[model samples]
Target: GKGGAEAGAIGNISIYDVDFVPLLDAAGQPVDPNPVGHGLTEIDHLTHNVFRGRMKEWSEFYERFFNFREVRYFDIEGKLTGLKSKAMTSPCGKIRIPINESS
Candidate 1:
């Protein structure tokens, strides 16, 4: 059972596939149907809050090597809260590179 769970964990850690879609003009209209040459349309910001130490290094690495940026940092007090992550963006709103450091 231990080996089986470890194998499953390893499998989950790997991302095998990704999907790309077209972006709209905010009026619910399809801007483009083609995806291959289009690349990512946006860069959404996501975060991982309430995490332990050395976790932020992973994000920092992406920022240094992968062009990601560390935009904002927040410290929640007196209660369990989420850290707000921030970054730059491209014209389209589909190519998000989230580098979150949990507090």
Candidate 2:
């Protein structure tokens, strides 16, 4: 039992038997899978809020520091709280962080 758990931990979660099956189109040509933006379609955004004018600076900061890009900017108009916002997402579309500011 010595070092068994440690050795198991190293390879436990790894998937090594990946089958490289080429996806074919209707005409039977292999499809190219390398797209420009790496993304996960179904993801969530962690909305971080700030004051109105600071939104741009904060968004740019995220883009420059982290590998995040601005996907959408929105002007939210709720009855009680109106806000100006922009949403930024990671390269894989996971871990989205939306920055909002009260308007």
Candidate 3:
């Protein structure tokens, strides 16, 4: 992009892929810190590990610590590995954590 293109957010900073792109105004003054596409939206989900047969314990931890509540459950068996998953989200429904036990 001639005016510079943007990549996804790394934390709150928007990444510009080009090597030499200036985020300056006509007088060479600094522009917005968040130059578009610059902030993390509500966290969709976070993936984590749980020992096999321990999904319940981990799920309970979220419920107790963050006051998260279970919103989804999944159990899938693939040819090579089997997995059990539980999705927990904060009371505001913004932060989500999906814990998985795979074998």
Clashes counted in candidate 2 amount to 0
lDDT of 1 by residue, 23-101 (tens): 6788988776655768866445554432466546666666676665554444544367454444433234444544444
lDDT of 3 at 87: 87
The sequence of per-residue lDDT tens digits that candidate 2 reaches over residues 1-103 is: 1424332223444232223457788999987788567656664667797976999899889889987998988897899989887889888777799898998
Q: Write the per-residue lDDT of candidate 3 for residues 24-75, one digit (tens) a residue.
A: 8899997776668877766678898978888889888889888999888988
Instruction: Tell me the deviation in Å of residue 29 in model 3.
Output: 12
Q: Which wins on lDDT, candidate 1 or candidate 3?
A: 3
In order, the Cα lDDT scores of the candidates are: 0.49, 0.77, 0.80
Candidate 1 weakest lDDT stretch, 10 residues: 12-21
The order by descending TM-score is 3, 2, 1
Distance from true position, residue 95, model 2, in Å? Answer: 1.3
Candidate 2's C-alpha runs over 4 A off are: 1-43, 78-81
Q: Give the Cα error of residue 9 in candidate 2, in Å.
A: 43
Model 1 TM-score, all chains together: 0.35
